[model samples]
Target: MEKLAASSLPMPTTIIADAGFDSEENYVYAVGDEKEPRFEFLIPYGTSVQEQTRKYKKDIQNAKNWTYCEEEDCFLQLKI
Candidate 1:
Protein backbone atom coordinates (compact mmCIF):
# COMPACT_ATOMS: atom_id res chain seq x y z
CA MET A 1 0.00 0.00 0.00
CA GLU A 2 2.80 2.42 0.82
CA LYS A 3 4.49 1.68 -2.48
CA LEU A 4 1.28 2.29 -4.37
CA ALA A 5 0.75 5.49 -2.46
CA ALA A 6 4.24 6.72 -3.28
CA SER A 7 4.20 5.68 -6.91
CA SER A 8 4.00 8.40 -9.57
CA LEU A 9 0.33 7.79 -10.10
CA PRO A 10 -2.86 9.75 -9.54
CA MET A 11 -4.40 8.71 -6.23
CA PRO A 12 -8.02 7.79 -6.17
CA THR A 13 -10.28 9.93 -3.96
CA THR A 14 -12.84 7.16 -3.48
CA ILE A 15 -13.53 3.45 -4.15
CA ILE A 16 -16.60 1.21 -4.18
CA ALA A 17 -17.39 -2.45 -3.50
CA ASP A 18 -20.12 -4.80 -2.32
CA ALA A 19 -20.83 -6.00 1.27
CA GLY A 20 -17.35 -7.50 1.35
CA PHE A 21 -15.59 -4.51 2.85
CA ASP A 22 -18.02 -3.19 5.42
CA SER A 23 -16.53 -4.99 8.37
CA GLU A 24 -15.25 -3.36 11.51
CA GLU A 25 -12.10 -5.44 11.37
CA ASN A 26 -11.43 -4.54 7.73
CA TYR A 27 -12.29 -0.96 8.57
CA VAL A 28 -9.72 -1.02 11.32
CA TYR A 29 -7.26 -2.78 9.06
CA ALA A 30 -7.84 -0.27 6.30
CA VAL A 31 -6.83 2.45 8.70
CA GLY A 32 -3.25 3.41 7.85
CA ASP A 33 -0.31 3.74 10.18
CA GLU A 34 1.15 7.10 9.03
CA LYS A 35 -0.52 10.16 10.50
CA GLU A 36 -1.20 12.10 7.29
CA PRO A 37 -3.03 10.18 4.58
CA ARG A 38 -6.71 9.81 5.52
CA PHE A 39 -8.00 6.93 3.39
CA GLU A 40 -11.67 6.06 3.56
CA PHE A 41 -13.74 2.99 2.54
CA LEU A 42 -16.73 2.94 0.23
CA ILE A 43 -18.95 -0.15 -0.01
CA PRO A 44 -20.93 -0.68 -3.22
CA TYR A 45 -24.72 -0.57 -3.21
CA GLY A 46 -27.25 -3.15 -1.85
CA THR A 47 -25.47 -4.54 1.20
CA SER A 48 -25.42 -3.05 4.68
CA VAL A 49 -23.72 -5.71 6.72
CA GLN A 50 -20.11 -5.94 7.82
CA GLU A 51 -17.96 -8.98 7.06
CA GLN A 52 -14.71 -9.98 8.70
CA THR A 53 -12.24 -11.82 6.52
CA ARG A 54 -8.88 -13.23 7.55
CA LYS A 55 -7.33 -11.61 4.50
CA TYR A 56 -8.16 -9.70 1.38
CA LYS A 57 -7.96 -11.24 -2.06
CA LYS A 58 -4.55 -11.41 -3.73
CA ASP A 59 -5.38 -8.58 -6.12
CA ILE A 60 -6.78 -6.25 -3.41
CA GLN A 61 -4.52 -7.00 -0.44
CA ASN A 62 -2.43 -4.00 -1.37
CA ALA A 63 -5.47 -1.73 -1.63
CA LYS A 64 -5.45 -0.76 1.99
CA ASN A 65 -6.92 2.14 3.91
CA TRP A 66 -9.36 2.88 1.09
CA THR A 67 -13.00 3.69 1.86
CA TYR A 68 -15.79 2.00 -0.04
CA CYS A 69 -18.81 3.95 -1.31
CA GLU A 70 -22.05 1.98 -1.78
CA GLU A 71 -23.95 4.24 -4.10
CA GLU A 72 -22.26 3.80 -7.44
CA ASP A 73 -23.45 1.56 -10.27
CA CYS A 74 -21.57 -0.03 -13.16
CA PHE A 75 -22.51 -1.02 -16.68
CA LEU A 76 -20.75 -3.24 -19.14
CA GLN A 77 -19.55 -1.53 -22.30
CA LEU A 78 -20.07 -4.81 -24.11
CA LYS A 79 -20.79 -8.09 -22.42
CA ILE A 80 -19.63 -11.28 -24.08
Candidate 2:
Protein backbone atom coordinates (compact mmCIF):
# COMPACT_ATOMS: atom_id res chain seq x y z
CA MET A 1 0.00 0.00 0.00
CA GLU A 2 2.82 2.38 0.84
CA LYS A 3 4.44 1.44 -2.45
CA LEU A 4 1.25 2.17 -4.30
CA ALA A 5 0.90 5.51 -2.54
CA ALA A 6 4.43 6.38 -3.60
CA SER A 7 4.04 5.35 -7.22
CA SER A 8 3.15 7.69 -10.09
CA LEU A 9 0.10 5.60 -10.93
CA PRO A 10 -3.20 7.04 -9.83
CA MET A 11 -4.62 5.66 -6.60
CA PRO A 12 -7.18 3.00 -7.22
CA THR A 13 -10.64 3.56 -5.83
CA THR A 14 -10.67 -0.04 -4.76
CA ILE A 15 -8.15 -2.81 -4.18
CA ILE A 16 -8.83 -6.51 -4.68
CA ALA A 17 -6.44 -9.04 -3.26
CA ASP A 18 -6.24 -12.78 -2.57
CA ALA A 19 -6.32 -14.60 0.76
CA GLY A 20 -2.52 -14.50 0.89
CA PHE A 21 -2.79 -10.83 1.91
CA ASP A 22 -5.62 -11.31 4.39
CA SER A 23 -4.95 -10.15 7.93
CA GLU A 24 -6.51 -7.79 10.50
CA GLU A 25 -3.59 -5.37 10.31
CA ASN A 26 -3.66 -5.25 6.53
CA TYR A 27 -7.37 -4.58 6.57
CA VAL A 28 -7.00 -1.63 8.92
CA TYR A 29 -4.16 -0.18 6.90
CA ALA A 30 -5.91 -0.44 3.56
CA VAL A 31 -9.20 0.86 4.87
CA GLY A 32 -7.38 3.45 6.93
CA ASP A 33 -8.53 5.22 10.08
CA GLU A 34 -10.12 8.56 10.94
CA LYS A 35 -7.01 10.46 9.88
CA GLU A 36 -6.30 8.61 6.65
CA PRO A 37 -8.04 8.05 3.34
CA ARG A 38 -10.45 5.15 3.49
CA PHE A 39 -9.54 3.28 0.33
CA GLU A 40 -11.94 0.45 -0.36
CA PHE A 41 -10.42 -3.00 -0.05
CA LEU A 42 -11.83 -6.39 -1.00
CA ILE A 43 -9.78 -9.24 0.33
CA PRO A 44 -10.99 -12.58 1.55
CA TYR A 45 -10.41 -13.56 5.14
CA GLY A 46 -8.37 -16.67 5.80
CA THR A 47 -10.43 -19.83 5.46
CA SER A 48 -9.25 -21.14 8.81
CA VAL A 49 -10.23 -17.93 10.55
CA GLN A 50 -13.54 -17.71 8.74
CA GLU A 51 -14.34 -21.29 9.70
CA GLN A 52 -13.83 -20.48 13.35
CA THR A 53 -16.11 -17.43 13.39
CA ARG A 54 -19.81 -18.24 13.66
CA LYS A 55 -20.88 -14.85 12.31
CA TYR A 56 -18.68 -15.31 9.28
CA LYS A 57 -20.17 -18.73 8.57
CA LYS A 58 -23.69 -17.46 9.07
CA ASP A 59 -23.13 -14.49 6.77
CA ILE A 60 -21.78 -16.78 4.07
CA GLN A 61 -24.71 -19.13 4.37
CA ASN A 62 -27.11 -16.20 4.26
CA ALA A 63 -25.26 -14.55 1.36
CA LYS A 64 -25.93 -11.13 2.84
CA ASN A 65 -22.47 -9.59 3.13
CA TRP A 66 -21.02 -9.74 -0.34
CA THR A 67 -19.32 -6.67 -1.82
CA TYR A 68 -20.00 -6.33 -5.53
CA CYS A 69 -17.72 -4.31 -7.77
CA GLU A 70 -19.37 -3.23 -11.00
CA GLU A 71 -16.11 -2.26 -12.63
CA GLU A 72 -14.54 -5.66 -11.94
CA ASP A 73 -17.81 -7.43 -12.63
CA CYS A 74 -17.23 -9.82 -9.71
CA PHE A 75 -18.54 -10.38 -6.20
CA LEU A 76 -16.03 -10.11 -3.42
CA GLN A 77 -17.04 -12.75 -0.89
CA LEU A 78 -15.47 -11.13 2.16
CA LYS A 79 -14.32 -7.54 2.54
CA ILE A 80 -12.86 -5.30 5.20
Residue 68 alpha-carbon offset, candidate 2, angstroms: 29
Winning model by TM-score: 2
Query: Lowest-lDDT window of 10 residues in candidate 2?
Result: 56-65
TM-score of each: 0.34, 0.51
What is the C-alpha local distance difference test score of candidate 2? 0.75
Candidate 1 residue lDDT tens string, 1-80: 45667999876665555775566655554565563435665754233332233343222434332445556543323211
Question: How far does residue 15 in candidate 1 sit from its true spot (Å)?
Answer: 1.6
For candidate 2, the TM-score is 0.51
The lDDT per prediction is: 0.49, 0.75
In the range 1-80, model 2's lDDT, one tens digit per residue, is 68877999788888889889988889778757774746878888777556667676557544556778899998777743
